[model samples]
Target: MRTPRTAAVLVPLMLLALGCAPQNSSTATDTSASSGANQTPADCAQGKTMKDGVLTVGTDSPAYDPWFSHNDPTNGKGFESAVAYAVAKQLGFDHSQVTWTKVPFNTSYAPGPKHFDFDINQISITPARAKVVDFSDGYYNAAQAVIAVQGSPAADASSLADLKQYKIGAQTGTTSLTAIRDEIQPTSDAVVFKNTNDAKTALANGQVDAIVTDLPTAFYLAAVEIQHGTIVGQFQPSAGQQEQFGMLFEKGNPLVACVNRGLAALKSSGQLAAIEKKWLSDTVDVPVLQ
Candidate 1:
């Protein structure tokens, strides 16, 4: 995903998008247990870190945007980058005390020891994932968007029922795939791709009517990746719940409580919202399909 260089246009649009409240009823699935109970963020983070005084973070390589910028995680310019630093600040680690390491997205949450204090790579909070690793409270609520080649039938859909006739596609194991089966419930079995690129290619080749992915990634595919791709619309993947992204941690790591404190403070103080506005503002324009 390409980061929008100009904040001039996207900021107001982002404000408008943020104004609409989510209709979903379910709360985020993962939250740190006893989040910093009886301890300050700094104290909760002490001695629990991979290093005594440094806050080590992990994210996948070639980090995409608008989550990361120019494939760099240390610049603190992208949404996740800025958020990670904000959390570190809340936990008392300054810029010079922080370090980043490469951790593949899947490996970051796998059942095993971890090499970083925390990992943030847009990993969603889910019951299954939470069983293996602890997660800070959700920092971003995500929506699924449909994308199709411009002028395709799927591009014309105005409602979920209108999409019932199409052969929808999504990457296997993603919430987008779950949306296809559980939300859209298309007439035919969905065309599951191995990854997002495969789904994008399928849409470009007219092998599938449409592809679904999180709204930000959908915007990226339509605006940057696929020359002819256009977003059809957006929707909450779960009918009554909004999907959310969380920072992952090793299970039983007390530092999760501290990170959650940072997220909580950022949310209440409006810094988190501001960071999201700066990076994800382009996502506001597409019509939302219910």
Candidate 2:
């Protein structure tokens, strides 16, 4: 997940991608509670704060490309980056009124209170994580897949049974690698990496046959940084396997309602679809978020 260093290449591609009409379909899951007669308060609170009035969001400092272009989360250039601002705008907050903070991925959803109004770092909503923090309706629904160098054994493995003999790598403590272990259970061995970059490098050096990551990250590596690679195929979600990215908020926080409202607005207005086409497709042909 590297940042895009050249705006010249990225900006035009972004415009071209957004020029088309979005496909018709709802992308967000329903997470709203039944409402009473008073809908004014709810309508006016799209992305607003309780008292401070400033929308504070948290993301990784060095956010990656196609998610946050060139580490500028405020610019709304990347898919999630633009979605964050879109959510803010729906909540009645201007871009200037919104603030950004850096939060490490590993501890962002830990079992405890949070310090930001909401966090948008492409975090997947899982049941285990739901025990600690509440997630807004999914802003993006993604799939997991394998990334392999061209002509490798994995390049031909289209199904779970086909991938059992390859050595794979996945970031530590992630479902991507877990899928490789519990599902594929490669015949050779599954290597572990601290991040996607490490896994990519390992693939380059022949340390592993393939690396399992979210479809978006796989697309990024295949299309942008690692021209030698390609995404094998997306994995089908098992009973506990589907992955959805959501706005992370503190457990029981009032901001969850506002975040969900903003997401619905963005999706309904086709803004989310625009962001998706711009960043995700240009980065990789495989649809990362739908």
Candidate 3:
């Protein structure tokens, strides 16, 4: 019989950060305006310190699983969710002072005013994106990985050249998809799914031989969702391939400075490392956010 562990262990661990972040897109204008019941003058400027002692955040609708469990990103119940609250606490806001809102991932970064304090979906900090939005020191470091069913060709691939023959899939508009197309140089067509779950289903049904995605997410899929599957190997970003996730803000906003400072503090105090081990390392080869 499969003896279940005590509920106490599972229940307590449930409160731990599970590595979730915002998935919506926004522009400077969206975060620059003052709106909502607690909106303030500082919010108009994307100021970190505002009246009402509140910190408002924008996330995506149906936020997606493993990223956000039970649609409660504000409860600090998942990985990025926990990071958001931790950063807010570092900035001196309590649980009651924090808030959450919905937005699309791409729209959050588009050029304009923003309505929330920051967005945290697992965004890769790219040079081009930095021109429009400021990023806090990276809170999570993610690596790209290849996953396949136990008996697939990719499962036996050793060198980059061997990876070329397998049809692979990843979420649309993600670094993982980019890596496979540009770096792995897959000879077979690369597929794009709306989300990871769909991709996992495709992989299971033999629709695709493999899936490339952020390491932790890949591991989560292999271990918990995809039966008869395992990660083949971790991939290193060719010179320009590395992706890091950071807290986002409007360009030139003072709030950026405070968020970075708080992140640095967390890093120095080893709290950040502890959090990383809790959510990321056990599953993937992703390094601590630099």
Best by TM-score: 1
TM per prediction? 0.82, 0.79, 0.75
Tens digit of lDDT per residue, candidate 3, span 131-161? 7777666565555667789987778877667
Show model 2 residue runs off by greater than 4 Å.
1-51, 239-242, 281-290
Q: Evaluate residue 139 in candidate 2 and report its C-alpha lDDT on the 0 to 100 scale.
A: 62
Candidate 1 Cα misplacement greater than 4 A, ranges: 1-38
**TM-score ranking from best candidate downward:** 1, 2, 3
Which lDDT tens digits does candidate 2 get at residues 171-213?
7656676667777777876798876677888988888888887
In candidate 2 the C-alpha lDDT for residue 230 amounts to: 77
lDDT of 1: 0.73
Write out the backbone clash pairs for model 2.
46-91, 47-91, 164-187
Best candidate, lDDT:
1
lDDT of 1 at 76: 95
